[model samples]
Target: MNTFSIKPTICFDTGSIEYLKNIKNKRVCIVTDPFMIKSGAADKITNIFKANKVEYEIFSEIKPDPTVQTVAAGVNKMRTFKPDVIIALGGGSSIDATKSIILFTVKILNASGDEYKKPLFIAIPTTSGTGSEVTSFSVITMGTTKFPLVDDKIIPDIAIIDADFVKTVPPQITADTAMDVLTHAIEAYVSTNNSDYTDALAEKAIKIVFEYLIKAYENGEDLEAREKLHNASCMAGMAFTNASLGINHSIAHTLGGNFHIPHGRANSILLPYVIKYNANLESGEETEAGKRYAKLSKILGLPCSSISEGVKSIIVAIKILMKTTNIPMNLKEVNIDKNDFLNKLESMVNDALNDKCTATNPIKPSKEELTQLFQEIYGE
Candidate 1:
């Protein structure tokens, strides 16, 4: 039997930030990045706290691909603050770090047998990517590897998508994050665990990304595009959270952690290559993943003569989108040293093979296959 679930209560609209006002008379702890605080985005939520008379503390030290040390520090702060509500108010990094903080804090409290109040968790995504708001997955970097932690306890109680927060995002970040949404939707749709419920959500998210990502990237001020992309991200997140992800994410996580590439960019760079690999049929039989890709291409009104042709069409479309949005088409274009990449290929392959997301991948790649795939992505 397949199980499907939507865990978070989501609010998506033009001024959804106002929902924070409902959080009254509580001690709230907000986890965010320094950029969000400095850029005045955090103020949007803080002002609501002030109006609601909610005492709050801001932990704004979260970095991109937040580390275990950073999460530990945030957990320590959360323990001392004893907040009634914990809000994650930035991009995927901040939301993911906050999730780790809450998870570990609860573990610590439970181990000590101390009475603790479970804080109401809220995720307000400042970017339209990662769907970290609704998902139970958190990607935390430890040393040179990214550990994707998955647990229902880390899922937010509420997800607030306010397009206003994404309005000022730079074009490059907008492109990167939007690609991340596409990756999530595609991976979820083709995942071995996918069900009708997940396929529906994933298809809608994919359609929205294709329809609006370019508009949002071209004109950040387009609130309609921004809102649609924001909703797409959340929809994709919900789909993947239940359906799980695939090897595309697994490979991306490994590359991002080791090479210091942005998570979204890493995913975007590896996407086309992974798609081709997943759709490949040595026995000349259509795989489930290939058929899914064909279906997606048909849904998007792309060319579809056969499964292979449909898959090729989808790949071409993604490449065009990446180029139009200025995303690097290969790892080599991202300035990573070729020698270093080759040196680390074995380790990355191992980590990717063991990734939690790999279990749900439609095609289980051997280490040798993964190595070749990585090299191909590196343009070797």
Candidate 2:
């Protein structure tokens, strides 16, 4: 059997949450946060569950960059509800918390020897980005370190994608999360661990991002833009979910894990710099540079004579997008003191080196090279 897991049955468009009524599970516990509730999406889901007569409960206290204690608390709530279904109805943090809760309640509860049982999970993403609805990885922040729980079992049994839910996303989030999509695509495409299946998906996702991200960021209420961005994000998720990512993500994960930086924003700030550094490698003409850079440039309607020029042009385009979206181009803008960054540089480098994604980088960096990359990003 060529066993590879995929996401749950996906439904897109307005009123797609109605599909929740047909779910087979009995008790459904919705793991979310106050923001989604405030945005009225939580109530929409609650009303849908109520209308369907499905027994449900809501644990809406999940924090941004969820913590272990938060997930444990959610697990405790699951123990109370003994839910057959877990509905994650927010951004990546909420979805991740739901995954951890399911694992703890199903796999870890009253179990031994580090074994876990996974329950059915359904995800309704209010954001057009993150693609958490279809992903099997969960990033949980515990203390100062962000830990990734990777397992196909975490993939949701259903993904309800409604662009209407994304209509209210502010431009800043649209930019940050959309950049996340781009990073996911680029990293997955260039990963040495990539396969043919993931490559096809990554290419399509990269095209979609170049076509739609800026439009989505500029006009949140544009349903077409929102839908395209949603699809792109999902495609990127599928790509990285299979082939994994590169140092941009690995380093971003480390910085976020250690310093509590927002995952998407960290990736956004580092992506251009990382690409610049990666492109400087004299690996070989047979490497991925031509296809990688040319495809992106063509997608963005930029003309370049060489792969190096195309790479530089894409970086410039990305920087322009960041500027237009009000995303700071460097880490200093996010308030990390130069001293703190320098002080923690060694640990951050170690963490990145240890990251699972690091093994697949198109051009692996030495400690000295990584240090230089960090300094460049810091000053950019």
Candidate 3:
């Protein structure tokens, strides 16, 4: 049975952050990284709370990739403050860290047989990537290995997507994150669990990324492009959360976990190769995934004279976008020492296989195939 369960009512608009005004008389706990807190972005939310006379606490210990230790610390802090609402601000790291912190807190509370109530969770994304504001998944790191934690309990009660918050994002981050949106849509569309509900969302996200990702990257101040990309990111997140992801994400997870590469950059770099593998273009075979790629190519009005061409068109289009946005095309560009990558190959392979995302991939990859992909993506 196919099920479609999209949670969290999403609120968006140029001034949607003003929704915080509705949060009244509630003790709120704000979770975010040091950058947001230090750079005054957190004030965007805090100012509203202060104006409204709402009580709150700030947990600014969030880190990139959200380490386990940090989550425990956040939980410990929260246990004391015991806020009625929890708001995650900033990018995926902040949202992911907040989710993990909440998950563990609730689990610990329940295990101890103490009465506890899940806080009203609200996520406001400052970046147009990760779509984490709407998803129940969070990536928590332990000594460089990322563990993607998934549970419905972690889904936020509300998501605020204010394009205004994204205006100050750097061009490189805009490019990387928009590419992450594209990856999410494509992977979700081809996932074995994809249904009509998810396809509609994924297709829309793909179309938006193809049309406006560059616009957003070229000019961070582009209001229309920023709004569209933010919406696309959320759409892709909703699609993938229901359809599940694939090995592209699995491999990206390992790349981020083992090499400390940025998550979106890792995914974008491997995208074309993963697409070719999933579509079986090299083997001269038609696949369900290939047909979907052709459909997507047709949607994009790319020349899709055949399934293979359609699949190839996606790879080409993405490469062009990456190059235009100045994203590195290979590990060589990122300067990862080949020997270090080679030495870590087996472990990366093992992690990819074990990744929950790998279960829904259209193509089940072998160890040799994964090794080959790792080596190929390393580039000469």
Candidate 4:
């Protein structure tokens, strides 16, 4: 008895850059990053707006894992422009910044003296992962705290997916971000809160990750591979957005917040360990998340003699994939000292235990169990 909902406006193909010109808006704000501008995507989008005779402003200072300060800055810029539409163009960071920017704009209006509300928003995702275009959740970092802003107000009015944007993604980034998509799909499929709708999306996304991630990583110029990965990433995002995540996300968020580890890298390395930890639980337990993992393992072509063996194969495959991609398998190689983890062990466990995603874990571990898991990975 699960329930969910997703609704996004129609999107044109990669060649539909000219669609920007047809947008019937007086003032439009294009939110992006400096790298995107230098990559020529910003100019292309702005040129489209020009062709359409649309007046637009470009804000290109959004940073990775955007801070609350940065989001507020973008909001302020949005207000100054007072655009009828906000177009987000770039990777997850840029798309995520757009969500916060729009949310901040709504807050401003709710408190402002003016009765008029702000403009509509659209998302043009240049990256394949993060599915920020179709999701209602936005991750915003503030100081040392990571907060998720959940509201339908920020969901983009339209999502334009273009394979062209991912053509130049470096091999390492392709591997890293694709792993994030796989985690999203796998986590969503096993989520205690998952609905039938999300389960279907998760299964499809998992297969797509297996089939396209490596191809895209090995050959960034392959448009077909890029398109498939991009679609899979978006589907993964859609799935996770509806079902929410589990302990892997909980621990990853805390670790990334505290250690400055890349979000995908942290999840990719810890996913197998967490899955193994979860599979050790007794069946017919609080949540049968292990069943979903076993199914995913078979889908990924991992050996599965039984449910437990299937789970183990999935873990081994993940580790092997990370190795092939040159991603570090342990915290030690990522520049995090073992002593620092030992010192923070108690707090980190508590932080992850209390995380919003923790409650959904099929088999929630006690603080001691979490410590053991952290320590095992600390020295590796």
Provide the TM-score for each candidate, comma-separated. Answer: 0.98, 0.93, 0.99, 0.94
What's the lDDT for all of these models?
Answer: 0.92, 0.80, 0.91, 0.80
Write model 3 residue lDDT over 309-379, tens digit each, in one string. Answer: 89889889999999999999998899999899989999999999999999999999999999898888999
Q: Cα RMSD for candidate 2?
A: 2.5
Task: Give candidate 4 misplaced runs (Cα > 4 Å).
Answer: 10-13, 281-287
Instruction: Kindly list the per-residue Cα lDDT of model 2 for residues 1-380, writing each as its tens digit.
Output: 22234566888777787787676547878889998877787888778777768788889999888999998899789776677777898888898888888877776565745333455678887776677788888888866667778888788888888787788888888888888888998888888767778878777887787778788887887889998888788878888887778899888988887677778889999988888777763554634744576667876678767786787788998888888888888888888888989998988888888777888888878999898888888874
Assess candidate 3 and give its lDDT: 0.91
lDDT (Cα) of model 2: 0.80
Q: After superposition, which runs of candidate 1 have C-alpha atoms over 4 Å from their true positions?
A: none
lDDT of 4: 0.80
TM-score of model 3 relative to the true fold?
A: 0.99
Question: Clash totals for all models, in order?
Answer: 0, 4, 0, 0
Error of 3 at 291 (Å): 1.0
